[model samples]
Target chain A: MTQNRTLSLSGERFTAVYHIVCKPAEAEARARDICVEQTIEFPEALVTDASIRDQIVGQVLSLQAVGEARFEARIGYPVEAAGRELTQLINVLFGNISIKPGVRLVGFELPESLARQYRGPRFGQAGLRALVDVHDRPLLCTAIKPMGLSPVALADLAYRLALGGIHLIKDDHGLSDQTFCRYEERVRRCAEAVERANRETGQRCLYLPNVTAPAGEIASRARLAKDAGAGGLLFCPGLAGFDAMRALADDDALALPILSHPAFQGTFCVHPDAGLSHGVLFGQLNRLAGADATIFPSWGGRFSFTQAECRDLVAGATRPMGELRTIFPVPGGGMRLDRVAELSDFYGRDCILLIGGDLHAHGPDLIESCRRFVAQAG
Target chain B: MTQNRTLSLSGERFTAVYHIVCKPAEAEARARDICVEQTIEFPEALVTDASIRDQIVGQVLSLQAVGEARFEARIGYPVEAAGRELTQLINVLFGNISIKPGVRLVGFELPESLARQYRGPRFGQAGLRALVDVHDRPLLCTAIKPMGLSPVALADLAYRLALGGIHLIKDDHGLSDQTFCRYEERVRRCAEAVERANRETGQRCLYLPNVTAPAGEIASRARLAKDAGAGGLLFCPGLAGFDAMRALADDDALALPILSHPAFQGTFCVHPDAGLSHGVLFGQLNRLAGADATIFPSWGGRFSFTQAECRDLVAGATRPMGELRTIFPVPGGGMRLDRVAELSDFYGRDCILLIGGDLHAHGPDLIESCRRFVAQAG
Candidate 1:
């Protein structure tokens, strides 16, 4: 497990790199304060023991001034301190200090012992490609729209979209267990509809249901979706917690491709010099938590994510890290049919081009619109 | 149940208010787009049916131009649309729109039918006061510190804090199932030590262990804490989704008071006009998720929460909601013994004042320092 080597070498340390923007004079003190705030949040006097001070306390590795009032601080935390758990790792990385401004988590360097504990991406890009039987083209995915539609109506839309050649169809993140469209009913009808359409058209179309619910109901719902012939599961890790998504990915019974939808998560990445970077928050963290594919607002969309941030996100998903598999970055939110070729070229075949409302805009013929989207992408 | 009244009232609608900052000319268009983006996310033509439009589409209620390019918009959604679930409710409230900048969720008004589904705060201000038997005075809560401490050392600290008449001794949020101090061992020893100290001093001091873990282990850990004789559970709702905290709170077997800690959640409320308001995110939402006490960084701390926001949070906790009990507003993060009286006066009797590292600086004698803290607060 590499545990012996990690433990033997300077008390099992993992480096946490933070992008800090503060007065150059205060950068060193701020970096030290981060160490204390994240670890032994007590005064220096309380840390009576030498071992606690030397072994447990975070050590500042390097501080490089990037610009005026901006410095990048690299700090090392004892790997044993995080217990090799995602939740605790996040806590050790940015727990108490997240309350303070001007400290953004840019990257992390996990020791082999710590990184081995996580099971990242059960069905990554290749697995997902195999699931949908899409070989050499960017996959076309869309969301069943207009929340508050009855299960029957939504399933009807799913049937048409599947028949028209969209490879992956998922419930809009908004379509939860509402009264008008209950989760079980929606999953059952939509799955059957997609299956029926796939059989008729001789195409492989997957219906991914949103299984985000109360903590108790999440697993059961995932099980239900699997039993109902759903191809994959969609969840808002931001709302349901990243660990919840990891739990589903790690589960044997409901072992299906999981797609993470970004909802109520913008606050973390929206700020330039606070919170986390796009690559770390959306890409690396999502992949580490076992997302087969992650959905984000595309650049040139209504959101504020810049082109550079989008590129970084792509890099994060595809980058190599230990045994973690590379994941597909699905870009949506204001993605249109005409831009399918442009986005396909931009993201290449590894990406899933998600076009939502724009599919409906290409006339009342939803099937024709889907066909055009697939044809354009190919 | 008020289901009849809520259902009968013209489609059971609930209003979500947002504070938006944009160009003066774009205010009206932005408000309309929010309704579309949050609800349908489809082309206007696809919302062909009038009934679908009326029931599903978010209707803009009011838009007031507050300042130059700053406006407040109120939008209504069908209460049934949320399915009376916290996850869906949050999605319908924020969801895709959260990615858009300049739009901040200010407040929400849920219909009684929707509100009744949530069991907010199993033990509220009065219930907690009854639990600790400290009816007239503010509660004294201190976090057992220095993350690298073993279970035995932390238990000893808990014992000393309890002997000194501290009402609640909690593991610091950072002490989450780490190899240095495992969860079960720490809970067992600390709970026993606190119990022994209570017996010796004839007090009701309680030990609250941090039970935050992976998604699957949370409930079991809560059960373990209860079985170990711990008085309460501390979890970072932000790190381990809010629903996880709600699940622990809702569990009948482990009916201990649940404390919600703000670990990686500061970004949501730090911004003036980009994320959620302090009252809604920290107060109302935490209460809805059944946090007996919600801990946040207080004003005049290392964090940046304002005085007005703190007051708003208290009001959101204690204000009358349908059947939800009023929760305790725990003001923490750099709280001190000297300010106990001032904070007590500010928050009144129904508050928990958390003093962390400062308690140790008082003297080498931990018990005497705690005694002074308790005496000062009283």
Candidate 2:
């Protein structure tokens, strides 16, 4: 089997998702029975009312179908679990839950015949080199506004930051579809502002926006962001699904890189001897899922990840991929400007450096403000 | 705020969903950049990619994108942040990867309100009492088979168990959409055999089939199971998303009690500190989600939860719900007939005693098999 992105659709298991529509009143029973038949992957099953009414059998999680003809359903089963060695890739396409209604398996893909698939990180090490016209050394990144900033206010910040030589500028997680600024409008204006600054300063900076939603509607937004002239879009794959990140990686029309966030994902890393290690979770998994750069809370930050964990994350990001590209690890969160050289020493050059609220408290000439970070860190 | 299950929509915060389709090739890139944008929350405001990619925005975390097209997409923003938040809701639907040509947002439902919509275990306490004919005491349950049991073999076991007075009988999670035990055939025979046993013993034992799949096709399957004379269904809300499970509870037409299973959900409990607590995750959440009975890995067994966690889980299950029914917690995973007394003592008489493989390892007489558990447990 080729370990490249261009995987053979045959043999590898496939999954097809479908969303069914039904009266809200009947959603739970419907979802349960469908999933049992699909994923339990067994036979002669019997469930009793004692089980249902007492939640002995069906454990309902959301009440979305509270007053509508909607219910979310999912069935997952291994393709070749037993005698069902494999057949019409379509039929077995995640046959686990295919029959359940109101559960449309939107993210469909072919799994490797073996345990793994793509090597991931398409433009990893060398590719990124070609993109930013950089052969070596690290990268830099900063945020625009955390809250309550107009689009122009954000763009003005983008211009000064871009001119001052920051590599990328993005909105804070809290900057989502808020009344203060809209996604399409803000992204468009910021990209333009960055482009204008690039023309004068001759530095290339990318503009990215946050995009995270339910199960549908991610594609058009990417297109919209692209049309608006933004460099890329950002998302929380854990909240959405890692497959969503995989999807973004495969779309060229959107033609931008993806950055993974750790919001709501801390639970997975907070435990030791349990859950994926930080390197494996934020670094390798994100890379495998096609992250260009994976972010983690740095040492001496408000968050609790240790310096060792941060270092391991960087190593995992830059490590080898079989016939795939390498990923860059972005270590940020509660960083101090005075420690710019320390961060550089710890992460080296091929990293995206992030600075948040501290940027503002450093004296307001925005340009002069950022130039200081560059002088000390660079 | 009225709690109407029919046609009422109410929520404190406006929640919308987005769905995006990938162009197949640029999937990874689109995935990576999206992460950067959302997490960094619009970095173009102050950083230059070259400088950051090469030098200053100094922080942590990095990103990379893929060149695959057929990827997934979705974005979530506050209702106040989006225009006609409901209109753009489609963008974040189907998980953001179902909006393009090849994919589709199969199913979704955003609760009109977020103030605890689901009231789990519809008839959790009282409902199950009415069905079983045995009020106020614990419910005894025993699984039917291991992986290699034939249909006739399983049928015989079901018949004996039902006649022996086991209140609930369910298929192992390992059984599913497989050739070994086809769903329809197994369900038909089991229901019939249990019926035959009921006639002879005058004991009405309800059969619970594991019904798990994507939400879309669940209605029909549920209808099929209900019509098939099966008593109820089983489901896994973790893998399929908790919302899918709640959808099942609202299903009164086939009003089978829902039994929540813990398969891929160990993570939620395994991380003692970070993830949800055993009591909250299993008890409160499941109760709120509508699980009449939830199956969890019992302590002093194969799984890792401690004795306190297990006890807390039971407490969570049966705790008082102001207007809703209390759920039964089914502690399983490697329990045996020998522990029936201990389990009963620990959980009291209101729980569903679940023992799987141990039943198989017991002397093969199905009648004696279930008799041992019920007699000893009670």
Best by lDDT: 1
C-alpha RMSD of each candidate structure in angstroms:
3.9, 16.9
For all candidates, the clash counts are 1, 224
Candidate 2 at residue B226, lDDT? 83
Q: Candidate 1 DockQ category? A: medium
Top-scoring candidate (DockQ): 1
| TM-score of chain A, all candidates | 0.96, 0.70
- lDDT (10s digit) by residue, model 2, range A148-176: 35677678878888888777677664455
Among these predictions, the greatest TM-score belongs to: 1
- Model 1's alpha-carbon lDDT is 0.86
DockQ of 1: 0.52
Ten-residue region with minimum lDDT total, candidate 1 chain A: A1-10
TM-score of chain B of each: 0.95, 0.70
User: What does candidate 2's lDDT look like per residue over B81-186, in tens digits?
Assistant: 3223321232222122211112222112233342234455776866876787777677877666543344565677788789888888887655544444566777
